[model samples]
Structures are given as structure tokens and as C-alpha cells.
Target chain A: MEIAQIATIASKEFWDRIRNRWVLAVALVFTAFALVIAYFGAAQQGAVGFRSIDLTIASLVSLVIYLIPLIALVLGFDAIVGERERGSLDLLLSMPITRLELLLGKYFGLAAALAFSTIAGFGLVAIVLSAKLDLNALYHYFGFMLSSVLLGCAFLSLAVMLSVFAADRTRASGLAIATWFFFVLVFDLLLLGALVVTGGQWGGEIFPYLLLANPADVFRILNIFSLDDVRTLYGLATVFPRALADPWLLGLVMLAWIVVPLGIASWRFRK
Target chain B: MASSLPPNDAGAPLIVAQGVRKHYGNIRAVDGVDLDIRSGELFGLIGHNGAGKSTLFKMMLGLTPTTAGDIRIDGALVTGRDFRAVRRTVGYLPENVVLYDNLTGLETLWFFARLKGVSPAEAGPTLERVGLAHAAKRRVREYSKGMRQRLGFAQALLGKPRILFLDEPTTGLDPEAIRSFYATLRQLRSEGVTTVITSHILAEIQERVDRIAIMAAGKVQARGTVQDLREQVDLPLWFSVRVSKEDFEAVRAALSHLQVEAIEAHDDHVKVRCRREAKMAVIEALARLDGRVRDLTVREPSLEDVFFGFSD
Candidate 1:
């Protein structure tokens, strides 16, 4: 539990990613997508120019749900297994640091990298949208950005867990992709199919809880439920109650999403 | 476990293993083994591949859990959280450690120094110690295999650890570099740093280590000084005599009077094998030829012979 050792590992991971152009590449992608969506999100509705921050956030929420999780998974899928394969794991584990410290250091380092790109990418668009929107709109957009970082951390945690549990790099990468596919695409469909088959009979009471199971869905509900127009568009008022949609509770869930998988990884790595 | 440790004039045993074993499913990597490495001793572990040298080394470092017995370092059992504190005072250079190639050699050393809680200022001197100071600023990717091994050695020398474990440290080193490597190891030993090194190349470490352990099939076949093992095996000595073309037959006839195990005759020289006790007698018989014998050489059994004798 030495902070110095953890900081050393974290700083190294941070520099390693920067040197590999991962941070720059991801930031550029986010900026490009956010700019295009912020400027042209209303074109589908026969409108153009910088739309309201609400519509911009709605567009970016879906974008972040798909993009951030994928980026995060790709970023961390090889964190542990790759090091083991590279023959560096023995050197690192032989150091004076604990396994927990190594796991946390790597997670924080990668989380910082993902958060940096998320902020840098979305912050640029926020500045552009600042002149067109008021303070309230800016606050909502920042919340969206914060949630995007959380979603990234959550997925990064899962990726690190997979890296620890998988036997090799190829298996780790495969598990990372499968995790992304399951959470981002298959989760919602499975939830909806379950609802339709049961006709809200068997698992109706646990439906909202099940939606919270997927961090991506949690990110979706957090951003989409905040705005009135977006809320009506997503239409989760019936199954998802108002109490469960509280921003604080949803944020806690996202934080748990980040911590639990990382905690499990630390446990498994120590074993 | 306490009683199993041997008395050490160098202070106390720095590393102790009591019947340590490791099992990977049905396969046994390290069978029951007992060992003691004293402080300031340069110990060598020689074994063929799959002989469990690496497994035993890992068990000592607590990198892998021992299946049945226990290992102690500095009198404290290396298990659970206690070993974490012990690790700070230990250094290890595993075989084929691929460092972060993107980092400059100095950056790599600094990172490990920080992890070990040493000052980054120590990186320069450590690199210089391993003769990598000139290339400290170069990226590791640009370095050769030998250079990377030196970097790994430099990292292990950080903080001047009390005990060092080097698994196949000289695998990729050139002859000159290997000489310098042993020189550094001797310097460390002079400073009272106990070193445990494993190498399959018995010749490389025969004279370098204070004591040697030969392992086979996941067990230590023999462990002691090279002289002690040689004496135990008591293999016959070899003698080669060079004589004039006319005197070669006379020398062979003189040697046939003694109990020669085997003999070979060339155009101008004769090679003979005799038991250990017969060495002096054989030399005396050759001395009777005196001026007729142009040259004489005695070949005692080497550590390699002892290693093979026990390993078989």
C-alpha cells in the first residue's frame, strides 16, 4: 500500500500511453465526433447550426456509450496479461510493492489517460457550444462529460479485470471485445426481449435493477433522463422509476462499476 | 525449519528452504528440497531445463507459493504480507526481462528506483556500475541483447540490496561482458551482499560461485563446494606426456608397469588414465623417463565432471 510505488507505476503507465500516441489519437477522435455531432445534430430534423446543448448531449451520450467503452476496453484489455507475456510481470511483481498497489496504479493511470482524452475531446466542443448556450445548458453538458469519463473508467475496470483473469493476450483481447459487445449492444436487447416475453409478468419488478447491471445502460439513463425532451424521446418513465434515476444514485452506481471490477482484479492478481 | 539451517561464519543463513515443493496439477516442478545460502556467499544453482531451478528461485523470492514446506529469509518466513517488507531489501534479475523499450535507459532505471523507494540520483551510478552510463539516454529498443541484460543488472543493483537473486543472468552476455559481470558480483560479495544465481552453463559459474548445487528432475542431486563434490565422486585423473618419436614407446612401456585404467598412444605423445591415488605413482614412473619426456601435463576432474557425475 505504498503511495510512492503506486505513483511510480501510474506515472510510467501515463507516459507510456502518451508516447504511443494513444491519448492524442483518442482525443482527436472524440473532438472530431463531438464537433460533427454538436454542429450537425439538428440536420436530421431539417435544422442546422449549433443546436441546443440538450440535443448535443443526447447525441453525445449515444456516441460516448458506444465509443468510450470501446476505447476503454481497447486501452486496458492487455494491461496485465500483456505485461505477463512481455516478461515484465516478474520484474514488477518482484518489486517491493503489493499486488493491490500494482492493480490500482495501473487502473488509475489508464483511467487518467481515458479521462484526459474525454475531457480534452469534449471540452473543445463545450467551448464552441458555450456562446450558443446559457449556464444551465453548459452545466448539463459538463455533467454529460463527467458521466462519459465514469463510463470509460467503468469499462476500463472491466478490461483490467479481464486482463488479470485471461491466460494470454489473444484471449484477453477476445474477452474485451466480447465484453463490449455484450454490454453495449446485447444488454439492452436482452433486457427488452425479456420484458416482451414476460409481458412485464415474471421480472417486471427487477427490470430497472437489471438495466443498472450494465454500466453502459446506466450511463445512458443518467444522461438521457436529465433532459425533458431527451427523456421523452428515450421514454423510460414507465419501467425506470423517478427514485432510481436520481443523478447521485446513478453516479454512485457508476463509481461502483469502476471500483468493483478493479477490486476483483486486485484480489485475483494477489491470489 | 530453524534446526535445518547450517551454521554460517559469514553471520547467519540469508536464505533457507526446508523441503519446499511446488506442484502444478499432476506435474511436480520443485520436489522436496532443502537449501541454505549464507550471508555474503556467492551461490550457484546449476540444472538442466525443467530441473526446477527457476521454480526454486521463485519460491525463495515468494513469487510463487510453496506447496508443502516453507522458506525463510533473514530468519523470517517469506509468506503472506511479511514478505512484502522483505522484498525492499532484495533485488532480482529474471531471465530475458524485456524492459519498456520506449523508455531511455536512464528513465527505465529511474522508474524502478522509484518503485524500490530509492533516489533517482542513484540511477546514474548504477548504470555506470554496469557500464551502461554512456548509453543511459538511449532508448532501450536501440540497445542490443547484451546491453539489455546489463540494464537488467543495473536495475537489480539499485538500493544496494542485501540479497540478490539472478536467474540465468549471463545467458546472452559476451565473454568480456561476462567477465565484467562476475567482477561486479565479486565487488557486491565483498560488500557482504549474498547472491544466488542460477545458470544451466555450469562452466560459466564454476569458479565464480563459492558453492554450487546441481539439480535434476526437480531435486538437488548434490550441493557443496566443487572440491567437495569432486572428492566425493573421486573420478580418475588424466595424464598426457609428450616424448620424442623414439622415446614414445619407451614411455608407454614404463607406464604399463603401473595400474593404468586406460591408455592411448599417438605418434609422439601418450595419454593415460589412472585412479586418484595412482596420480603420484604415474608421475613418478614418467619422471623415471626424465629427460626423455619432453613435456608432462596432469588434468584433474573439473566441476563439469563432478556435475555430470552427480547429475547422472
Candidate 2:
């Protein structure tokens, strides 16, 4: 709602996190991750070399969807609490800016940082795919990056919310990490179990609704956006057709996760 | 800086509160109270532990909503909505002034400056003025407590606020830092800034503040100038006279000449305080007597007396 304040905070957050060792170190770590994906995607020059597209796309998809959100949580879980503990919040309040400004600033900062990391890390994926192969997967690769970014934003918003509401930064960080684990590592298992209990009947209709709650669903849909050219193959060959069925609707739903949680956090910050 | 605020009958003061309260569950911190702070006056809030000075400050700052009554600034009522706007004009420094650990002093300064819409070039001079220009390039993590305090001051002073709030600004500071901090406050006062400082150390704000409010049981028990607070108590003044060992007996014998109210004889001096207005007359009367006066000090009742009297 407050534009100028949000821009200022966003710029500061972006620049400040850029200098954070944890954030910067993760970027380097992601750079290495990009290389690993490229190697696995293309190293099979002779043995089962189903072309470099398969392995690289799979690796980039997995890293972008799963790993990036975790990185976001790691970075943002202390956005507010860290300032409060350090007593900077008190000083910040004394300034001419409002708490809403502070909230929007912090969110924008984290988002900007994520954008940088996403661009650089996934740009590397695009680079490798473009150079090492026919450079055909560039378009799909960005789709993965864009979807991953939107999903990551939702996770970052949740992290910031936890940071503000929890009693302390340590507890906030712990809760943020736990939430990430539930979505990334455990939710899929829970979904599969639910589908199994219904004897595969649940997988068709009701399971998709269940998937919406998990932040991973957004990433899945975005990844489907990257594979638009091969929708027919996905239906015939891959297990990812669930997201491919109607990607646009899924994209909007994923975006809602980002906007809604952050909206609540801005409200809570004022409170 | 010695200017009086809005005259004595200048309508409602800039900040007024009636029966303001804050209750954090069982701990009903700030009970019902009334406060009136005139514009441009340095008002000090003094209290013992659990007296709720900080709680009141938080309520006023809109960090926490008040349980009851009203808090206003510049005639604008502080509903939850106006917190951001009100905060812009109110600068605050907490007891423990910590800053962004990873940011350089300059970096942190610029960050706040940017928030206030100040350019880095404009902020540079302020960093220097706070005596941290040389240290600006250094990370705040490497800064000393005093340095951080100054940095916090710089941040708080960014907008040249109308109302400034500080909670125990002298906690970790050394004597020199304390003095400079006061000097800075004095400068702000000269700039017509209204400051409300909460501190347990009465002596710290004893001379600088225009008025002080002493809080107990979550409400202001007494509020006035140091001289006025002294009047509220059963304060009788005291005079201390120091002389050579041989002159002790003579001064004791001459105590009757001054018609003194009470006398407590120390090893080297005699202390006297009377209801009579003529403290100088006693000294003059002592010179005419057999007493040999080496030194004399007339004692005014300390802030401790005022605070402790209310404590009881």
C-alpha cells in the first residue's frame, strides 16, 4: 500500500542481504549446484545419453524447486527478530518511516536478494544448457527459475512472519526450518499416503486440492510451465502431468501464497 | 534552551495522558495515570524497578497498544493507524543501543538515512558530526558500546524530530560519553526538541531536565521540578561547618548564638539545619563567636531524598 517506503526498505533489504555471508555463501553453493546438475545432465555422453536435456532439466528443476526455497527460509527466518534482538527495531521506529514501511522494506530486500541468486544460479543452468548442448532448453529453464522464485517468495514471507510472531529469533529460525521441511521433504509423503489409502481413487480429483496447501505445488506447476513444449510427451511418458494439466490456474494459486502470507505479516507488523 | 514551554496556561500540553494503563496478563504494568508534557521541555521519568517507565514509553511509542486512556502527540490522537506517521516525528534510543552487527557504521547510518530520504552525501556530514566519521568504514560489530550508542544517536537524530524518547540513555556509557550525550541532548533542546527520558539515575537528569515524573506501582507518584519535588517532602536544609580540631569545641559552644534547630557533630565539623531563612547569618554569627570556621558548605536536599521519600 505504501510504495515509497516499501521501495526504500526493499532496496536496503536487497543490498544488506547481498552482503550477508550466509546469503552470499549460498549463492556460491548454488553455483556449484548448477555445475552438478549440468554434469549429471550431460556427462552421459555415451552411456544412456538420452541427450543432455533430460538430466540437466531434471537437476535444475529439483534444485530450483526444492533447494532454493530452503535457502530463502534460511535467509529470511530472522528478518524481524534479528533486528528486534539487536535493538535496531527501536531505533528504526524512531525514524520517520512507519512499521509498514519497515515490513515492506524487509520483504523487498529478501525478494531482491532471492531474485539475484535465482538469476545468477539458474542463469548458469541456462548457460550450460546453451553451450554444452543445442541450447534448446533455455526457455523452459527460465520457466523453472521463475516458478521457483515465486514459490521461494511464499516461503520467505512465511519465514518473515515466523520471525515477527515468535518470541525469539532462534525459535523463529527453528520454526521456519521446520515449516520448510514439512513442505519440501514430508508433505509429498503425506500426500502419497493419503492417495494410497483411497486406493488410487484420491489421486485423480481430491488429491490436487491437498497438493495446493503444500508450497511445493507451486514449484511443480511452475516446472510444468517450463515443459510446455513437451506436454504431449509428459502425458505419455512422465509422472508430472498433474501440474501440466492446467498450468495457468496453478500459477495464480502459487502467487496467492506469496501475496497472502506477506499481506498478513504486514498487518501483524503493524500490530 | 531554557525557554519555557507554551506558557503555564497554554491550553493542553503537547503530550497528555489520563489514566493510561498497560496490562500484560497478570502483570498490570502501567496502572491508571495522568501526564502532561509541554512542547520543547525536557521531561524526565524516574522510577524504581517494576515501576513501568518502559511500559509507558512502549505504549506511547505505539510499540504496544495501551490497555486504557489516551496518548497523543502534536494534537494528533494516536490510534493504531497513526503509529507509522507519529513515529516519523519521534526519535527514540533504548537502554541498550545495539545496531546492525554486520553493517559498517556508515552502512547502517546510510540505511537509516535512506529510510529518512537522506542521500549518502548528506548523511556523511552527520556521521562525522557524531565523531564516528573515522569509524564509519568499520563494521558495527567491531564498534564499542559507546560507539554504538553514538551511532544509535545518529540514527535517532536523522529526521531532526519534534519529540525524542530515550530509555536509560546512560546505562553503559562512561563518564565522558555520558557528558557528551547530555551535550547532544542540550543541543537538540536548543533546536526546540521535546525530549522524554526515562531513567532510574535521577542525578543524570537532575540538572538538565525541565521537570521530572516519579513513577511507582505503575503510576506517577509525584511530578515536579527538583526544587518543587524537594518542597513536597519534609525537607529541612542542612549546613556543614569544618574547622581545625582545636576549633570544634568553640563552634559547638557558639551553636547557641545562631539559634540553630539541630546539630550533629562530626569528628572535624558540625552539621546544622534550621527552619530559619538566614543560613548566611549563622556563618556571620559564628565568626563573631569563638568558632574558627575553616570551610562551610550549605547542603541542599538531594534527589535521593525526593525519590526515596516517594518510594516509602
Candidate 3:
């Protein structure tokens, strides 16, 4: 594919978000929420000062699991379907660019916006807490930021895929919300309910593998498994085997979450 | 104005479609149609809504795939691997062209110009060419419908494309803007740019286009110059002969022996209708009246009349 054509479309999407302050607004939201959870995470136990980095990250993970996917889906659900509904798809398709280039460009551009906001918003918290922690704590914080970006990218890819398959913006949006509800809220509950109803005898061996099916759970494991204090505190270390907790493996799974949906979007858009 | 061009057969065919067909289930949007559009020619494609003119236009631009046949631009397949090169030389203005409302008029042109690999610097002059220079810095959301149409025309004029495909381009423009729009088209024609336009306003393009294609029921019913189509349909011609109230019967009596179809008298003029071949004979009969016929004018079938005759 021609990179120049891709860049042209990507830059438009990127600048549209930048100029409208969408990135800034999201970044501010991230920074505010992270700082609050960092300082006030142990308030229920009568603590108010900046807590341990492990506890801060654990609290932040809960917030991000629900927030990032929703932001990504809202950002990208209308990328293609909106153009079709507004009657501009014909003009854009008439250009010299290929359908693959347009799809990739749109994905990369919005991904950049989401990544930038996630990094800036949470990275600011990392700086404020750096004086209280050691290098290992800073490493974990940076890892948290990176994984958050990947999670957003994965959800954004799904949003774009829905945009291509949907006939109009209204339907695309409905599909996006339904996707959010499935991955972020219902997937894990259904798995847990199955395990409980079966009394742990039916899905004990496959339960950890099934957790990888949801990117939100994957993000949770990726962050929570790396910290020893929080790993025992969250108690998920019992069910999830140490062999599957490799940071690189979980990162690859997250990358798959981003790539597979984008690939499907590209294929469907070309048709 | 279209008469200023060279003969119809002068230029080679720049766009060729061969038995192209697009079928959606049982509906034949474009069915086995073949057409050739010559370079430096202003061609018009006129048809009723849902007659498949837009579908055919999309196929020619490679925006929609043809299910059965092929469309080639400049000897290259429109949907081939090398279509990027073909697309660079073409510009299109879709019907009811929609642009981003958040961008300024100049920014809209720049966005398209960059996509076409043209320099963003060209956006200024392109907007000026379409009479949108005054609103270059204003957001498109603030523009009126006529202004938006002009901006869409400006976007199509970017990159100096060799061919232009305009679909109902003058939809919301006033009469003055429509004149200016066609004037710009005439200027482009002199530079050897082939234009294929579709318009519901047949009268607006009858005198401007070099050749016309009338489509109906997913097929081209007639294709030729306006005069050629008029003759092809064999529609009647009319003559308005000015005569005094007293000489009305005398004027009618002059053509009584001829094969005139109908004769009706108003206050001071007699309207005579006849076949295309009887034009000269009827005129000669009126000439025999000498000063009795003070004035005489012949009216051929209009483009709308011809459109209805073919499309209906």
C-alpha cells in the first residue's frame, strides 16, 4: 500500500481530534482520575496520602478497564459509517488511494490520538509519584501506561470494524455500545457464573485460557500479575498459572486484539 | 457556445465502457451498456432518477465495481492494479457533494488536494477560481447551500485533472452561479479536458454540451447532439408566422395545399406545426405570402421535449 496516501488520511483524522481538543480533554480526564486514585486509594481503610505504587496501579486498573474501551469505541464507531451516511464516502473513494490505505490510515490516526491521551494523562501521575518510589515502581507505572494504550487500540480496532460492517452511524453506534457491554461488563461474569454453577469441575483447566478472550481481563492480568503485593492482594494469582503470566505473552495477546479486528475491518471495507 | 469546439469526431475516446453491468440481486442498475467519451468533449448524461446514470458514473470512476464488464480510462482499466495513475488524472464532484463542516473553505480544498498529491498551496487559487475566495477562511458550516456547491466545485478543480465527472453539479446554485459554473467548464474545455456531467436541468446543458446521452430503464435510449436527437426522435417543428387579423386566413390558405399538420391563429400570429422534412416546404409556402407574413420564426424540439420523447 502507498504510505503517502495512508499518511494523508491519517493526518486528517489525527488533526481533527487535536484541533477539537478531544485528545486534551481525554488526557485531562486520565490525569485527574489517576491522581485521585493514587492519593485516596486507601480512604476506606483510613488512609489519605499517596499510597504504595502497587495499590495505586491496582486502583487505576479498575478505572481504566471501564474508561479506555468506552472512549475508544466512542472515538472510532463512526469513522467509516459516518462518512457513508453524510454522502462523503463517494468523494473519498474516488481518490487515488486504495481502500486498505484509507482504513489503515484512519486506524493509525485515531490510535495515535488515543495513545497520546492515555500516555500524557497517566504519565503526569507517574512524575508526581516518582519521588516517593524506586526505579522498579517507576517501571511498573510505565508498563501500566503502555498497556492502557494497547487496550485502547484494541477497542478502537473493534470500533472501526463495526463502522465498516454497519450500514449507518446509528447502527454502528448501537453495535459499539453493545460491544462495550459484552467485553467490559458481561464476558468475565458469564465465565465466573459458568465456573460457579459447575462447581469448578467443568472449566477449571480452561478458565485461565478463557480469561484471555477478553482484552479487559487480559489488561487486568497484565498489570496485576506483574506486582507481587497486588498479585497476592487481588488473589487472581491462584487461578492464573505463572507460566501464562509472562508479560511478553500477554503483550502479544493484546497486540493480537488490536491487529485481528483491524485486519477484519480492512477486509470488509475493501469489499 | 458549444459550437466553438472542433468537430465531434476530432478527439480520440478517452473513456471507454464495454458491456458494463452491475446487478444487485435481480435489479439491474447498469445493464450491458457500452459508451465512449471523447477527449476535449463536454458530454452530458441525462436521465430520470433511478435510471442508472449515477451507477454508470460510479463504475466509470471505479467507485463501484461492475459485475459483468470493464471500464477503461486512457487505455487503462479503471479498477485495475494501476488505477492510481488513472485516478490522479481524474476529478469528480458527487451529487449533493458533502464536505467536513468543521474545516474552513480553504482547508476543505487543501484536504482533497493533499489526497490527490497536489500541493496545498494550490487551494487558494482553486477556491478563487470557483468564486469562493471571499469565504476561504470561513468554516463550511457557516456557508449557504449555494456556497457549499461552489466549494464542492472548487474541490473537483484541484490537481488540474485531465478529466472531470460532475453529477448534477448545479443543484443549489442560482441562475448567475450556474452561468458562471458553465463558463468555467467552457474554459476547461478549451484546455482539452473531457467532462462528463449529469443534470436534471436539460435546458441548462442543451446549448453547453457537445454531445448528450439519454438513459432510460438502465439503458441508453438515444445518444447524439441535441439536433441529432431531435431528428432521431422525428418530433414535429413549429413555425410562428406574424400576420394581421385580416390576413390570418390568407396566411393559412398559403399553406393549405402543403402537408402542414396543424394551423392555429392567435391575435396576430398563426402557429403552424409540421414534420421535420416539411420544414423547408412550409417556410417556402409562407414566403410566397410576401408582406402578408410580417415575421416568421421556426422552433425546433427543445431538449426537455426530446428527453421526454426518448426517456418516456
Query: Who wins the DockQ comparison?
Result: 3
Candidate rank order under DockQ: 3, 1, 2
Local accuracy of candidate 1 as per-residue lDDT tens digits, B30-51: 9999999888899999888898
Q: How big is the positional error of residue B261 in model 3, measured in Å on the Cα after superposition?
A: 2.7
Question: Between which residue pairs do clashes occur in model 2?
Answer: A9-A105, A10-A105, A13-A109, A14-A109, A41-A56, A96-B88
Candidate 1 lDDT, tens digit per residue, A240-259?
99999999999999999988
* Native-to-model Cα distance after best TM-score fit, residue B222 in candidate 3, in Å: 1.4
| CA lDDT, candidate 2, residue B85 | 60
Q: After superposition, how far is residue A5 of candidate 2 from its true place, in Å?
A: 1.3
lDDT string, candidate 3, B1-312, tens digits: 122223334489989999989999999988888899998999999999999999999999999999998999878899998788888888899999999999999999989988888889999999999999999999999999999999998888888888899999999999999999999999999988899999999989999999999998888899999999998999999899889999988887888898899999899899999998889989888888888888989998999999999988
Using lDDT, give the best candidate's number. 3
Ranked candidates, highest lDDT first: 3, 1, 2
Stretches of candidate 1 above 4 Å error? B1-11, B243-252, B266-268
Worst 10 residues of 1 chain A by lDDT: A124-133
TM-score of 2: 0.86
Worst 10 residues of 3 chain A by lDDT: A124-133
